[model samples]
Target: MTSFADLDLADVEEVAERREELLAAVRDHAGRIAYHIARVDGGDYGQRSFSTDDGEWTVKYEAGDLEYLRFEPRGGGETYVISTQQPAEPKALAEALEDYPAFVAAYNDYVDSLAGMLDSVEASFPQVESTESVVTERDRIVEAIEACCDRMAGELRRYEGTEYGSFAARIDGTRWELKWDEDGASYLRAGGSGGVYVLSQYGPPSAADVREYAPRFGGFVDAYNDHVAELELDLETITFET
Candidate 1:
């Protein structure tokens, strides 16, 4: 599976730049608040604008008290939670600045992990390299397989009141199946209108049974590829009838 090191050089640099920019913005916001308090000494109030990864933020002050913070996103995504209108406590701004980077980092890690999942899926279930008209349909199926894998990897939660045998992710027009027993063994099968692939029974699934399952598929594919390589297999070894 590809790691962060394998990501495009430009992409990594971009993330670094974004992180730095956010930190700077947080500091600038804090500085503005401090300046207001100093200049007015309980007699001043104003607003300071700062940039964030999502959008521009306006920190408001009233009579040397932190009044509120508002964000207007560049991408127009809803800001889930805004600042409370009540006066913010001392050091609250410092704490917010301190946590800003950590929160962004956590979300970035999550997205990276999902991308890794897609890479693993492609690695495990490689598509045939061909240019024939017959191969075109197979290519489409391969794309669907990738999409399904990505969606599944993005969400690993089990539905409450749902049985252990249920798989959480499925693409429309594709069939997905999961079978498990009390002994901790499970099997996953997906495809149809896409392409057929089966993962034989594996045991001791981890982390809500989703994390271990994806890796298991990747491991199985890797092992199969190694075996095929050792056998010196080639496309010429197979005969197609149609």
Candidate 2:
């Protein structure tokens, strides 16, 4: 809850000097340092991180207050975290630096482990085959589905009268329906239950609508075929008769 203004000016100056000293020490040891700061809760929060051949060091602060100083060694050893209400002292910083070499070694080992994991995963994958034949087979099935729909639509059109009429068929245990109204507007439904899907909203279903919707119906047919194939049952293609 302490604000920056509550701190004495001289004390703040001393802390700033110590911070610069710590940064200089880090740069001298690591040859490189990264510092970042952002506004947080109407105050400034910042972090400085630098790496040595041994490990990494991170210093975090809120305004001028030291939040925590952390040192994580490379590879995998114990992480040291120091938290104090006041800024870190020179002795504490020097002690943390002693573990830097261990940290670096641990980190390198971690990287090697990750590389080994990736190599193992890559080895487990089977060789992929060309997809051209798969795509051609899919196109062939879709064309056949479209043809079935077209034949069903043609048969529905041949039914006389504005009165309601419908034709039903069973393919692979699934019932399909093509129903028409007095106006000749047609609907198609798959399965014994569930509402019919209107092929044409404004008018009777057209050859164009059937062609456009064939791919969607082909998806259903494909899934059905896959289900039956998995059960070791014969795959059945949808067919219609007048």
TM-scores, all models, native as reference: 0.21, 0.34
Model 2 Cα lDDT, one tens digit per residue, 1-242: 11223335467566566555655454443322112222222346766565666667665666545556577656654333345445444444444556555544553464465555545455466788986775565556545654555554554455333366666656556666666655443556656566334243443333444444554575554554464365454324545679
lDDT of 1: 0.44
What does candidate 1 score in Cα RMSD to the true structure? Answer: 27.3
Best by lDDT: 2
What do the candidate models score in CA lDDT, each in turn?
A: 0.44, 0.51
What stretches of model 2 exceed 4 Å from their correct place? 1-12, 20-69, 72-94, 105-128, 154-172, 177-242
Each prediction's total of clashing residue pairs, residues at least 3 apart in sequence or on different chains, is 0, 12
